[model samples]
Target: IHVNISAEIIKCPQFVRALTIAIVIVCSKPNHSYEDFFDHVHVKLLTCYIRSEPLPEPEIQAREVQCLYGIQIMSAALEHPGGMVLRLFHKLYQDSVISKESFELWKKEDEFKAGFDEDLETKTMAVVVLISFFLSLA
Candidate 1:
């Protein structure tokens, strides 16, 4: 929807790729509840981030785990802008669909704290902006 199917947003290629993965997972399951969608999307991303040859670490790529949670929030926000972002986040929290740990993890991430560091090339500044507006209901 941002452009052609293979297109990546120029400013944040890594984040855009991550966003695309989130969007695809959502589009593939329109009727899935947030819980079900979360479980399903998480597995899909693990496949992309993990390798069979050798295990990277025991953390299960915690950064991606939190960002996976973040993109779902971001996607819903984009789909329905305005205060809907906060509202959806609250509902997700109340329902226990998203955990408090994920919120904290996202906030601590370097991309969230360090501003738009082109050096990292992740450039997930949008998530940082969203976090600043966050209410921290947890």
Candidate 2:
């Protein structure tokens, strides 16, 4: 689980994306249970994201990790729906792995407009997850 990137370098945008991609890689592993995935996410997320200083403006870093993670992790998340996926989403925000600004930007942007515009199901699922995560906040 030594993701190779240093704490200082983890502040970089590319490294953040790479970290997220690592999460996706673990998620896509075949035959894994949600519990197993949960363990992996907890470890990697805490190690790579929480321990490092969050990327902030004026710091010059990529900020799309949340949106990218939402889209890429959709399939794996959909498997557990309100259980694992929703909890992961909550942890992402609560732990500040996803910033409030990122969620706001995610809300404003048509994330699926590029190629997933025609995918009503995917769009719907993304919305559901977003709403669910928000509602849990209230």
Candidate 3:
């Protein structure tokens, strides 16, 4: 899960590409779930940033943590069903784990991309579960 990215590219574009490649390599490792991979990357990236520069403003750190939790919850919800997921999503939105606008956009996009009638209850449950998971992490 701990990915080491090193490159000679100094240009921003090339650096981004290299970073992406590093992430891909880490994520593609066997026997690791996406959530675990993400956690590892987040911890490493945050640690590096903290060590190399001024610490993030408290608000920024809080927001980043929220975002990470939101992602984790979303992944969890995708694997289960119930009203809990929906409630969790709503809570995250309210708590600013995800911006409301972004959540709406994601919801719309997901609906469109579903390609069929997905169960409303299930979708709601997934969101709730994801939100709950995020809060728990926080």
Q: RMSD of candidate 1 to the true fold?
A: 9.0
lDDT for each residue of candidate 3 in 15-95, tens digit (9 for 90 to 100): 322333344344544454443343444445533432333433543343333333333343343454234234434444444
lDDT tens per residue, model 2, 96-128: 556566555555555443233334455456557
Best candidate, TM-score-wise?
A: 2
> Residue-wise lDDT of candidate 1 within 9-98, one digit each (tens)?
322224433543565456444454444333445444434433222434333344334444445445544453343334444544554544
Clashes in model 2: which pairs? none
What residue pairs clash in candidate 1, if any at all? none
lDDT of 3: 0.40
Q: Count of backbone clashes for each model?
A: 0, 0, 10
Better of 2 and 3 by TM-score: 2
On lDDT, the stronger of 1 and 2 is 2
